[model samples]
Target: MRKKIVAGNWKMNLSLEEAQSLHSEINDALETSEFNCEVYHFVPSIYLSTLLESDQKVNVGSQNGYPAKNGAFTGEVSMSQLSGIGTKAVLIGHSERRQLFNESDILLKEKVDAALEEDLKVFFCCGETLEERESGQYKQTVIKQLKNSLFHLPSKEFAKIVIAYEPIWAIGTGKTASPEQANEMHKSIREAIEHAYTQEIAQNTSILYGGSCKPSNATELLNQSDIDGGLIGGASLKSEDFLKIIATYN
Candidate 1:
């Protein structure tokens, strides 16, 4: 079956103590959750050890990582190191990384390759900017991103990936892609995967919608045929709202 996941991207927000407290809160909520899906906390790199050491019920991952193993890259964490630290997953090509860090499709492909090589699940994020959407190139833009960075993987390696379609226009802007809009892109993503791999791979792939997905709109977005779950952002920092979003699947 396709994976159903709600991954909270706690991007560079919480300190170690703060992350620990939030993780504890989520753990307590999960005790009564009964939601039939996977949950992941994509915590900041410094807090990964602290966060994972406290919680074992839900999954945990890093927000980003370097493609190399161990090297002199001053501020980078390697995929092997992340895996060794018990990180079950890692986010590759999040828009912030691509935008702020200036990560290219070539660089992202290297990151994806390293993550999979180390047996880590990759939450590969791909999306279009506001201008691209306004110019009606959203579909083509996203497809090209996937093809250049992820589609080159062997089908088997690709299976370890979960695609999160986060339209740059909506993320953190409080603007959301209407359910129809999100589903349309999700269908296109799945179709692109099918064209590159196989029907079974496309059918089993978990394509998440990551644009302003909060409790208010998660239910409607998830109810669409192609959207599996969310790569939640700000709302995830709030314990109550995070639980509410996860509970939508139940």
Candidate 2:
């Protein structure tokens, strides 16, 4: 079966003390809980080492990292640096990074390659804006993102990837795609992967839905045929809310 995962993008939120408290709560809860889905918290760069030092069951990752291993790129951390510090994953091509920082597909492709080189699992994100969605061209937009940035990889390297489909329009906007809409897009994504790779590869790929997902809506969304889990946002900041979403898989 494809891996079910619930990953939180803390997105520059939470101070060090708050992060510690939240992480502790999550760890303490998991100690008594039973669930099958993998759990991860993609936190700010500054708090990575500190949070990771704890024996928390939650997996930790960086929100962004440069493609270069070591360089004069001031203010940027390389994938090598993250991996060397025991981070097991990184989020690439998130809509905020694409919109705010102007990260082109070319650069994202390089980041994917670099992260995989260091054996870090890549949570590659792809989605469409409201304009594209209204125009009914959202499918093409999302497919183009995958083809441009991720399709270049060989199957072996691609196996380390987990695709997160976060509708740009719904993300942080308090809007969510109905379960049907999300599953339709997710099925389309799986078809695209099957065309590029093999049926087995497509079947095994874990495609997550990420757009204002919370405990209230997570059950319906996760119950969809194609959606395996979520890339949670606002709700993830709260330990109680995040754990509720995790229990959806059970």
Candidate 3:
């Protein structure tokens, strides 16, 4: 069975102290819950070690990592560094990175290769612009992104990857893709994977729904056959809400 994963992308939010407090709160809550899903938090690089040191059941992930193993590239975090700090996964090619940092598919592919080379799992994000969705090219857009940025890897390495589908229109806009809408896209994504790889890989890979996922709609969203879990945003900051979302699988 595909593993259910709920990953929090704490994007550029929270200070060191605030992150510590939130981590502690989340750890406390998780201990009291019976949820069996794998939970992860993608905090800033600075808080990775701090969170890893905690007794939290949550896995630590990097918001971003460089494509290089070691280089003179300033301001870039390498895969080796992230692995050394106990990062189990890294979020690559998030919508924000594509919009603000101009991260391209070529760069994202390199990052994925680097991460996998270090044995770290990858949360590979792919989605469409609002215009593309309105024009009915959402599936094509996502397919192109996945093919270019990820499918190049071997099937053995592919097993370590998780795909997150985040509609750009809904990311932080408070407008979520309805459960039906999300499932349609997720099913299409899974089909794309089956076409690119094998049906076995497609069925085994976990596809997560991102874009403002919260407690209010998590149960419905996660209950879908193709929707394995969530790549949460704003809702993940609160301990109660995060736990509630996790409870959906229970």
Which predicted model would earn the best TM-score? Answer: 2
Error of 2 at 97 (Å): 0.1
Model 3 — which ten-residue stretch has the worst lDDT?
Answer: 27-36
Each candidate's TM vs. the true structure?
Answer: 0.98, 0.99, 0.98
Model 1, residue 42: what's the lDDT? 94
Off by over 4 Å in 2: none
lDDT of 2 at 180: 97
- What is the RMSD, in Å, between candidate 3 and the native fold over all Cα? 0.9
TM-score: model 3 vs. ground truth: 0.98
lDDT of 1 at 70: 87
Clashes of 1: 0
Write candidate 3's Cα lDDT for 1-250 as tens digits. Answer: 8999999999999999889888888778778778879999999998888889866688889999998777799998999899987789999989999999999999999999999999999999999889999999999999999999989988999989999999999999999999999999999999999998999999999999998899889989999989999999999888889889999988
lDDT of 2 by residue, 77-190 (tens): 999999999999999999999999999999999999999999999999999999999999999999999999999999999888999999999999999999999999999999
Top lDDT hit = 2
Better of 1 and 2 by TM-score: 2
Give the candidates in order of TM-score, highest first: 2, 1, 3
